[model samples]
Target: RKYGGAIETVLAHLQESEERLKNIETFEERKEELKKILAQQRENYLISAREIHDKRTKAARRFEKEVETNLKAVALEKARFEVRIDAPNAADLQSGNNRRLTAKGFNQIEFYFSANVGESPKPLARVASGGEASRLMLILKTTAKAGDAEKSVVFDEIDVGIGGRVAEAVGLKLKELARTQQVLCVTHQAQIASLADQHFLVEKETVGKKTRVSARDLNEKEKVEEIARMLTGAQITETARKHAKEMLGAAK
Candidate 1:
């Protein structure tokens, strides 16, 4: 009986060891499977991020190059353009969550300019004078639309800083752009506004004590009156109205 009890105890010990080994093997197999899944997910995320960055980089480079080329074609050869991209730290790029390109992304892109020859290009915000800023904005916007597949482009206050021949050049540029994109400009300048496919007058009127905004789509006769008001400001004289008519006819 003593020998039989000793044999049973040894068999119990061996069975416990086998169970423990099996448990350890099962845990190691699960760990390996999890590692493989995680690696595949990481790879997929990286591939998607790279694809997006490539597309955006391509578009940005194309637009910037085209604008620079067009500026040189015109006499505005002093203009320069750039796109700034922020990159991740090496440690973060290697170990952390996958990074992706966004609309704004981790980057800040700004248009830069230097109007005068031999001057370094500065940020658009640093530009001085309303006229210079307006012109710069127009040039940037116009050049951006140069390769646009759109059918219409609208300019609000495009003539803010321009007058005389410069204003005429703006009008001509608008007309040229209109060849591809229908150009709509809101202007105080009779010269600039006259180039529109359609012109409407915006005005403020006081009814009782409340001032309200109103817009009028002017006919040929009313367009003359509206242009006269813009030229003379509030008091529309006969001479100013006649001048508005002449300006309209000249614009044609």
Candidate 2:
């Protein structure tokens, strides 16, 4: 009886061990399934990212062409503007074979420019002057397709260092761009100010010990006067008003 009881206990222990082994094997199988699912998701993400990269590459080329064409209108006749897409190599990633991605894309963009003939294109920050930069930005805004975040574009002193025919070109360019997008340009040149769909005069006044700055929207009469003032400074002459009227008429 003792021997029989001992055998029964050993069999029960062996049975318990088998159950534990089976449970362990089942858990390992589940872990492998989870790993496969994670890998598949990663593949899908990479595929989508690659598709986005391809689209941006094509769009970048088109954007570069449009901006270059507009640059000529801003009097940069010999200028060369390029939009470069710097895509990363697979070897640069942490996994060595995986894509390096960011929220924007897997590529970095740089605007390169050369303002004069025979000059090699250089990075925008390294090459373009303040006026050149402003004009370049204007060209970009004029040609670029508006995104969700770009509701309005404002230009402050884009007419700086530019006048005469160039200023007129800038004015006409801005006016044309405004047809497609909302544009607010602050300019002191009579040529540029005359083209505004809505004109506002910015003035500063001394009240007591403090200085205050105010912007007042101009009516037709006010616009003419303000544009005349821009043409001849504080002295609004009759000739300047007649010239301002002519300019306003030509702008339309």
TM-score of each predicted structure versus truth: 0.57, 0.75
Residues 1-252, candidate 2, lDDT per residue (tens digit)? 443468888788789889999988799788999999978876676677778889988988888888888888788888998878787766564363544566665778788999999999999999988778878988887677452344677887688777888899999888877877788887888889889888888889999999999998889999899899989999999999999999888877
lDDT of 2 at 161: 76
Error of 2 at 240 (Å): 2.5
Per-residue CA lDDT of model 1 for 1-252, tens digit only, reads 433468788788779889998988799888999999988876676667657667767887887787666555334456676654445555765775445334444333556667677777777678534555555545566776553546655566567645766676777767667766666677888767766666788889899999999887889998888878878898999999898888888867
For model 2, the superposed segments whose C-alpha errors exceed 4 Å read 1-25, 93-99, 102-104, 116-127, 147-150, 207-209
What's the residue-level lDDT of 85 in candidate 2? 79
Query: Best candidate, TM-score-wise?
Result: 2
Instruction: List CA RMSD, all candidates.
Output: 9.9, 7.6
Give the total clashing residue pairs for model 1.
Answer: 0
Q: Give the TM-score of candidate 2.
A: 0.75
